[model samples]
Target: MLIEVEDDFRSSSDKAYEKIFDMILTGQLKPGEKLIRRKLAEKTGVSTIPVMEALLRLEALGIVESIPYRGSRVVPITKEKVRDWYALREAIECQVMRIITRTLTEDEIADLEKLANKLDAMEQAGDTEGEEFWELHFEMHMIMARKTGHQSLIDSLHRINLFRLLQRAQYSATEHKNQIPKDNHHCLIDALRTRDPLIAEEVMREHIYHSDSMI
Candidate 1:
């Protein structure tokens, strides 16, 4: 009976986490917005316990921060932080491309190509702001990290990705009108297929830096 109760609690927490996460990603919860646990619980139709658990998980992921005696808020977005994130992301993901170039199997390459094509189609269809597009975009990069079989690299990318989504949401909330090039992923995939680490790294660096103008 206790185990069943625990499972129910966990399920509720997971649902709360997803709801909160979606709210943030969809820009309904802007950066640095204060999170009231009771309000969130009411919004998510869960109890305060689950909302608290969800916030703790988001805090662990660096998406939320708890202030002393004040409660939690979404992590603030700043130009300096965005630059730092880009730098770290370039360092990590360039290495990811280098590793993938040397180790990725033909089948894996094909799979990545397929995913990239789907992303291109979505972008061409003007669906960039949708949640599904962002999810797939994250998945596309994660697939590359997984190909390297490096758990540390994958974990780092996972954390970085959450911030990336937040950055994108913040950007969209602004007046910037720059659109990501439609051929972006296609170009990266082409470079990776060259099987040259230097070439892949160069392309990946360009790709990462391209977002600088958006913020």
Candidate 2:
């Protein structure tokens, strides 16, 4: 019975988290918006405890920020933060690309190419909401990062990815910018296929810089 109670709390927390996360991503919760536990609990049909737990989880993801003696709010994407994030992302991704180029098999390269094609179709279909576009974008990079066979590298990239999502959410909340080009992924895949680690690294650097310009 004790274990059952614990499971129930965990379930509620997870549900609250997913609900709140979707709300932020889908633009239901705007940037810099103050989050009230009671209101969120009411919105998610959960208790305040679970709502608080969900806010903590979102804070960990960089999607929400907490201030001492104040409260938690959705993280606002600023130009400074965007620049810092892209720089860190470039450094980590360039190294990951180098490692992937050295170890990626043809099958993996082909898979990435397939992802590029899908992204192209998504773009052409005018995914104005950007949810599908960013999901596929994250998927393609995650596949490349996983190919490195380095757990630490994968973990770092995942953390950075959370910030990327935050950035996208912020963008979606305000202006719709064509920051990431549909062809950029295709370019990176082509660079990997060249079998030159240097070329791949260079392309990855340029790809990340493009994101900086968009910000």
Best by lDDT: 1
TM-score of each: 0.81, 0.82
User: What value of lDDT does candidate 2 attain over all alpha carbons?
Assistant: 0.78
**Over the stretch 1-215, how does candidate 2's per-residue lDDT look in tens digits?**
00001244588898898888878866689878999898999999999998999899789767799988888998887888778777878888998998889788898889889998887666555664546677777778888888888887777777678777766666652242444466866888889988888999999999877766656
Over the stretch 55-143, how does candidate 1's per-residue lDDT look in tens digits? Answer: 99889878899999999999999989988888888998999999999988888888899989998888777767776887888889988
TM-score of 2: 0.82
Whole-model lDDT values for every prediction: 0.84, 0.78
How much RMSD separates candidate 1 from the native structure?
A: 5.0
Lowest summed-lDDT stretch of 10 residues in model 2?
Answer: 1-10
Candidate 1 — what's its lDDT? 0.84
- 196, model 1: CA deviation in Å? 2.1
Q: Give the range where candidate 1 is weakest over 10 consecutive residues by summed lDDT.
A: 1-10
Clashing residue pairs in candidate 2 (N, C-alpha, C atoms within 3 angstroms) = none
